[model samples]
Target: MTIFWTIVGIAIFFVGLLISIAWHELGHFATARWFGIKVPEFMVGFGRTIWSVKRGETEYGIKAIPLGGYVRMIGMLPPAPGKTLGRSRRTGPFQGLMDDARAQSRLDVLPEDADRQFWTRSPWKRIVVMFAGPFMNLILAVGLFAVLLMGVGQATDGTRIRDVSECVVPASVAATQEVEQCPVDAPPTPAAGAGLLPGDRVVSFAGRAIEEAQGQQLREAIRVASGPTPIVVDRDGVRVTTSVNIIDNEVQDFQDSTRTVTAGFIGVSLLPDYVRQGPGTVATEIGSMIVRTGEAITKIPERVPAVFGAAFLGEEREPDSPVGVVGVSRIGGEILAQENVPWQQDVSLFLGLLAAVNISLFLLNLLPIPPLDGGQIVPAIWESIKRNTARALGRPDPGPVDAARLLPVAYVFVLVFLGFSLILAIADIVNPVPFFG
Candidate 1:
């Protein structure tokens, strides 16, 4: 049953992936047509076409391999200066490459398409056509985040007490071994002695209001104080006040998960709550995610070797490390197959995962390197500036920037990306990151 659900989850992700790809391509397709550019095909994959339909001037299709998709706009790579369009010679370096590209680019370009070619458009229009794909992903990402935050609610670190411990013991040591309870010599925990009970919501601690203080701030206040301290708890809709002596004890550090520290112990467990968020909170979270993703992108080169080692050498994989599409799909499936949690929780997690993936796609495609959206955007903006400056200086109209020369660079970029993609795929299968952990 678990295996069946896992497979179902994987299938669900692929369907979502296909939708995202189509949405992205639709952005480019729609905008290109709006700007009068000749679009030959709008494909949602990279291999042989398994299904296709001709609609007007464009062929819409689904291909065999579902790794990625593309929007085929005629004259994306303009013809050589003073050279006939799609007429490539069998001489010079990259001549064959240019020939094949020019041939495919203008597959059905008619004589009337001379003005309809993408190169005939002004630089701003071309920039919009190239940037529209990633921008669509960004829009989707924001919408997904808004849904996840407002609809599913956010898991918050509130001041609700889930449980109370009777005796004092180091949580680190307790985790390592199965000790039934604290030893006879152990003292009563502060919360237990102070009559703290399960389901008691902390109203305040050390004269600080929980409404203003949150559970973490109250925790820090408790950890820093000693002697008699006043705490108010809301039990069964009634506010109750109590006093307890905070004592120094060895326990797991709340701030740093991996370390143990000696701090004031209260012996009560915090229960996280799911709270609704407003638009401002959603915006803030989106900004934070963008920053984190940007930092992760910067560290991707450094993390590849670790993934490679984990895949082949049986090395431990860090949960925070980079994950590929396969890893995300596997994790999504595992989330669905989880037996202990509610199905709603699985849906929330999957939505969050999809949101994150869209965010990544948005930023990655914006990278100012060849073959990516930002690559062409940069050249288009530069060409616009050059042309504008030439006109302002009473000079002749500078021709469209010949971007066909970047074919070799784009090839190298694609090859390097393919290599990394292969490595990440293997790592995802061999030493996958644990979703629950």
Candidate 2:
């Protein structure tokens, strides 16, 4: 049953992935058409086309590889100075590469498309057309986050006491065993001695109302009490008042398990609750995710060595290391197959992962490197600046910036990315992250 559900979850992720890709490409295609640029193809994959339908000068299709997608617009590159449009003329070393790129870019430009070519549009329009794809991803990410926060609700530990401990045992002893058994010398837990029952909703402790303060404050109140403290709880529609002797004990720090701290002990466990989060909570969480992702990207140089070790040297994989698509999909399968996990929780986690993926896509596409949307956007912005400056100085309007010159740099980036992807894939298959455990 777990295996079947795992496969189902993977299938669902692929479907969601296809939808996201198509939606992203749709942004480019729609914006390009709006700006009068002739789009030849709108594809949701790479490699040989598996299925396609030609409609109104655009061939919409899915390809064999499901890695990425693109929208092919006519004349993405401008011709070199003194060169005829759609014609390639190589004059020096590596010039052939530039000429071939320009020629290939203009190949789909028909006679009527000469006026509607992408390069023929103003620089601002070009920026909008290129940026629309990533912006679509950002929009989807935000929507997913909103749904997860407001609709599904955030899992939280509430003030209700789920269970009370039988006795108080030393934290140092508990750390070394699966279940710590209280010895004759151990003291009775405060909650147990106070007769606090399960399902009791804590109202106040030491004159501080639980509803008006955070859980940490309540904890601190218990820790600081030198003697018996008054506690109020709601028990089955009735308010129950009691006094519990807050005994000082060495307990494991709630935030850090490795260390122990002297605090007042009341061994009551919190009950689970789903707290509805506001838009501000959603924004804060998303901002934290973005910062963490940026930190991960910046640490890639330092972490790549560990990836190689884990892939080929039988080393343990780091939990916080970067993962490729394969690793993420494996995690998705594990998340779905987790035993005893409710369907709602599984769906929430899966949606969260998908949201993170979309966020990554949004940030990656905006990188100012060629073959990426941002690379073209940078040149368009530069061209806009140059043209405005030339006009202001009474000089001739400069033609569009030749993006073909950066083709070699784009190729290098592609190769490095592919190599890194391969290594990560190998690491994922052999030393998969133990997310299930």
Candidate 3:
């Protein structure tokens, strides 16, 4: 059963990923068309085409590898200065690469495409076109998070008894054991002594209404109570009054599991329920994820050694370590296969994980390093600044930024990215994140 669900979960993630990639490309395709740039291809994934359809002038298709996708736009790179397309006389170290890039960029350019070139668009419009893809990812992430946090709510302890312990166990023992129970010589806990049972809706602790109590949590009420305490619970649709001696015992601290604090024990576990959160909570969580993801990006190079160790030397993988697409899909499988987990909770977790992935994609594509949307953005911004400077100095329009000159850098970027992808794939299969999820 676990194996079945694991496979199902991985399939779900893979499908979801392809949809995300398609949606990302849609952003670029739509904006480019809005500005009259010729788009020849709108592809999801890479490698050989699995399916395709020609609509209008665009060839929309799915490819074999589900890693990434692209939209082939006409004139993504302007022609070499003082040279026609496909006719540049290469003269320098990187000029051959530039010429090739310019030639490739011109393949979709027809005689009528002179005014429809991507490089001919206003710098601000070009910026928008480049920015749109990642913006879609961000929007999708926010919508997913909103659904999980605000619509579906979050798992939190509620004012109801899920279980009642038969006997009291020391906090240190309870922390280490899979299940805590009484030995033959152990005495019954106060809750058990008072006959508290599962399915009881806790109404009040002492004289305070349970709903009005601090955070509506019974633990805090029990922790501060001493001697005999009155408890009210809604049982079988009727209020049932009871009393128990709130015994002081060492328990795991709420804020930190590593420390123990002396607190009152009643021997009952609160039932967990979905508690709806406000938009503010969603904003805070999104903000935190952004910061964390940004920090992780900065640390990728530093973490490669650790990834290598885990892959080759049987070292343990850190919980917060980097993971590739394969690793993440595997994690989705593990999450669905978790035992004794509610289906709703599982779906929420899976969606949250997907949202985090989207956030990573959003940030990764925004990196100002050619070939990437962010890299394209850099040159557009530079051209914008340059044209503004030229106009102020009464100089001639310098024309479009020759993005082809960046082909050498783009080649290096692709090589490095592919190399990292290879390492990540090896590590994912050999030493995937130890998902004790």
The TM-score ranking, best first, is 3, 2, 1
lDDT of each: 0.84, 0.84, 0.85
Candidate 1 ranges with C-alpha deviation above 4 Å: 1-4, 84-91, 158-170, 173-250, 262-270, 339-347
Q: What is the C-alpha RMSD, rounded to one decimal, of candidate 1?
A: 4.4
lDDT of 3 at 87: 62
Worst 10 residues of 3 by lDDT: 210-219
lDDT of 1 by residue, 1-437 (tens): 99999999998987888888788888899899999888889999888999999989889999997777998887777766655555554367887677677677666568888788888899999899988998898888889888888877787676878778888888787767876867999888899999999888888788878862277777788788888899999999999999988899888888777889998888887766667789998899888988999899999999888988988888899988788778888887898888745444677788888878888888998898889888888889989999999999999988888777677789999999888888888889999997776
Q: Which of the two candidates, 1 or 2, achieves a greater TM-score against the reference?
A: 2
TM agreement with the true structure for every prediction:
0.80, 0.81, 0.87
- Please estimate how well model 1 matches the true structure, expressed as its whole-model Cα lDDT: 0.84
Which candidate leads in TM-score? Answer: 3
Clashes of each: 0, 0, 0
- Please name the candidate that would achieve the greatest lDDT relative to the true structure: 3
